[model samples]
Target chain A: MTDLAARQAELVRALLADGPVPAGFDPDRVRAEAAALLAKRRGVAARLRPDLAATLGDRFRPLFDTWARENPRRAGESFRADLDAFARWLQERERQERERRSGHRLD
Target chain B: MGLPTLGVGIGWRSEIDLTVERLPGVDFVEVLAENVSPDPLPESLRVLRGRGVPVVAHAVSLSLGGAEPVDPRRVAHLAAVAEAVDAPLVSEHVAFTGAGGLDSGHLLPLPRTREALDVLVRNVRAAQQDLPVPLALENIAALLEWPDGELSEGRFLAELVERTDCWLLVDVANLHANATNLGTEPGRFLDELPLERLAYVHVAGGVRHGDLYHDTHAHAVPPEVLEVLGELCSRVSPPGVLLERDDAYPPDAELAAELAAIRAVVSR
Candidate 1:
């Protein structure tokens, strides 16, 4: 990658993927920005996927935020695709919870 | 200099479609380019356009400043929307949204270096070629700055305008946030910009989150943000001013009153 592209990737990674604060940036401010960016993404996605957001109800934001912190958005992925991924993540999590409740562990 | 005068307007969201329609003296409306499709226009937008109100397509996913080249499909989508709505111009942002393979999901600030400027210029010109109308780039508010920026925000914007012949969509609320959080001088920042190339202005609401002033379009337009709008008005009569309220929309009367406040500033 070129220097400009590489540096932007580092910054993007730092914001969305819990990467390091980079060489010379202020850690506190960047952290705050990252938190804000995550929230904005969640908010915009929620607006786009009103059905999923309504289905998830109040848990939508917290659940999505948690999943987002881990999943992070892939560049060039459409918002529709990202929301679908969120829905799938929610389904998997629910299945795991149900299995645990039934005392049946499955792959 | 051929930009049309878009008296005063508000952002059109699905949630506030009716409110925007009823808002008195709404000269025009800007819709999110990503949310709209040219094939089948939304009924609400159709009604607004019927009333002779212009709709400007404001896109967020262009990533014009990304080191990676601008996406052709995204540019085409924005152009189609502009042609469908007959927008006098379209506006994106001066900042890049994401780069590489990870999307930050936020309009991140660019390091104001000449090398970065070269990348932005190339991407902007390429996108401009595909666009049917003039393209105006908005200045975004950033919570943090990249280390070792070679140029100030104003100088960077000036150079972009000079090189690409693109217009600007200056966000007054963002200027206020930068002034409070980054100690950016509003006067100097305005002076350094080429206002003649300004296509329009965005006035939104922001609130203070400790030391940082968050440009939350969900809140009421604070007096300080209005002060910045007033400052810009004093310098030059902007071609148009649009109010942006993305979330927690107030009542119809309240939104109208906010528009009135903006009208009051520009008419000063």
Candidate 2:
């Protein structure tokens, strides 16, 4: 890649993924910017899949933030994959909670 | 300069189809280019077109500033939508959405360096070559500034317009966000821009999140943003002003009132 292209890619990684804040960049500001991007994505997911958003209720933004921290957005997918992954993550958490509740009752 | 005085309009979305259809004062509607298929245009858009209300194709995913060349398929889709709508012109952002093969899912600002400007100019010219209608570029609201930027946003945009001979899509809400967050004066930013190149203006709503202003488009148009619109009109009345409400739509009456308010500002 050209130097400019390489620098641009590094900046995108820093924003979307957990890549390091590039040299000579303000770390705090970039972190804030990354958080803002994730928040915007969360809003889109909430709009596209209101059912999943409602199911997660208050924990929606936080959970999506956690997921987005690790997963970069796939081009042309339009967050369908992210929403599906979020739904499954919620289901697993619910299942774990159910098992814990049943174990407590048995005790 | 070829665009007519389209008056006040709204961004058409599926959620607010009935509202947009019934809005009386709307002169035109802008459809998200990515959302419509020319083979089967949405009924809402067809109704507007049938009524002789102009529909402008506005694209969000072109990623015109990305390091990669502008995707021909996306440009072709935009061309098809413009033809389908018979639009006077189409609009896309001056920002890049993705790099390194990952979609940012939102418009990200380009570094205001000469090299970045060259990349944007190249991509924009490519898209312009394919598009059936003229293309206007909108400046986006960004929270972060690249440390490597050498020129101001206005100078960078003016140079791009001069180089490409393209039109401008000035989003007033975005100006407000940048002015508030980046410590730039809105009027000064407007002055730096080539106002005569304006095809239309975008007026949306946003909220102040802590120290930053977020141009959410889901909130009500605040007075400060309206004031900036008023200032722009005082300088040069654009051919059109569009109200963009992507979500959290209010009642029909509320939406109408917002359109009326925009008309009042532009006509003043």
Candidate 3:
């Protein structure tokens, strides 16, 4: 294959290898779920700062790749669970940021 | 197929919305169909059309060079806009924008070979079938040269015209920028093209990146490109020559001055 074709194939392979985690895989699911949650949180953080969004996609993509690989057997369930946890975490984090901005203190 | 040669126009950007509506100077405006589409046509474009302004449709996102089938959806969208504005001419770049599910984020040059030409011809034929008027393809600038084993740029373009029977929207600025950046001879490139096939000419300004000059289309037309355009006009005698200002857009006042300069050069 030509260099361009080779590069394209490599990208497709990488995406495919990072498969969905299977059902009832609790430990792997928890880890992948946690990672995806963190990623969403980071995305929210990046949005408030444009430069971070620009630079972070590359850095953060590896995290997803790893999570996908770790939960490869139960990739779908784990990935979704992690994503749900991440979204929950992001909401809480955003609330805290808003509270902090408003000078509200937690005991 | 034979569009009247309306001499020296400018590509109207929506950013200059208020300016374009108020000004009556530019001989004509090349309206970007990509910007105002699927959404209602803006009030400004309607006013321009009503006032008998000759608008030419210029499009983006055709992805003509990509592996995917020509998106009939965009063609329908463009065809509607052309009829609405009564655009005498429509044009797009002869470069691919995205490939392999990754957005390249810019126009990417195709290798000038039979394979690439075949791809281009197929796509153009598909587009022209849907479009009311002939579709002209613009030459794009690139940093990398094809790894030989390909047709010359001129030959590829000339053959494309012959094969597809499409018109040429020659961007003199892109040709000049590519020649300077790629070390290709501009004069020879100009000479080899089928000038009679050109429907219009686009001239713009650019910046130098390292040793290579980039087609930024930011500034006023450079003297050399202008000189080349002057020569091109005499040789081809096309009806419309447009000045494209995509970045660092000068104020309408400054744009008027540039348009006046173009009018002088092309009319001469």
Best candidate, lDDT: 1
User: What TM-score does chain B get in every candidate?
Assistant: 0.98, 0.98, 0.94
Per-residue lDDT of B1-268 in model 2, one digit per residue for the tens?
Answer: 4777788999999999999999879999999998879879999889999999999999999999988877799999999999998999999998988888888888888888899999999999989999988899998998877788888888888999999999999999999999987776787788889999999999999889788898888889999988999999999978999999988889999889999999999888
lDDT of 1 at B205: 94
- What does candidate 3's lDDT look like per residue over B1-268, in tens digits? 4767767677877777678767646667888776666347777777877888788898866867654566687788788888878888788888765444433334666667677778788889889999987788888876555454277788888888899888888888888877776666777777888888888888888776456666667766778788778777777677788888765778788777777777777778
Worst 10 residues of 3 chain A by lDDT: A71-80
TM-score of 1: 0.96
Ranking of all predicted structures according to DockQ, beginning with the best and ending with the worst: 1, 2, 3
The regions of model 3 sitting more than 4 angstroms off are A1-107
TM-score of 2: 0.93
In terms of lDDT, the poorest run of 10 residues in model 1 chain A is A98-107
Model 1 pairs in collision: none
Docking quality of model 3: it rates as incorrect
Cα lDDT of model 1 by residue, A34-91, tens digit: 9899878888887889898889899988899889989888887877899899889989
Please give the ranking of all candidate structures by lDDT, highest first, separated by commas.
1, 2, 3
lDDT of 1 at A13: 85
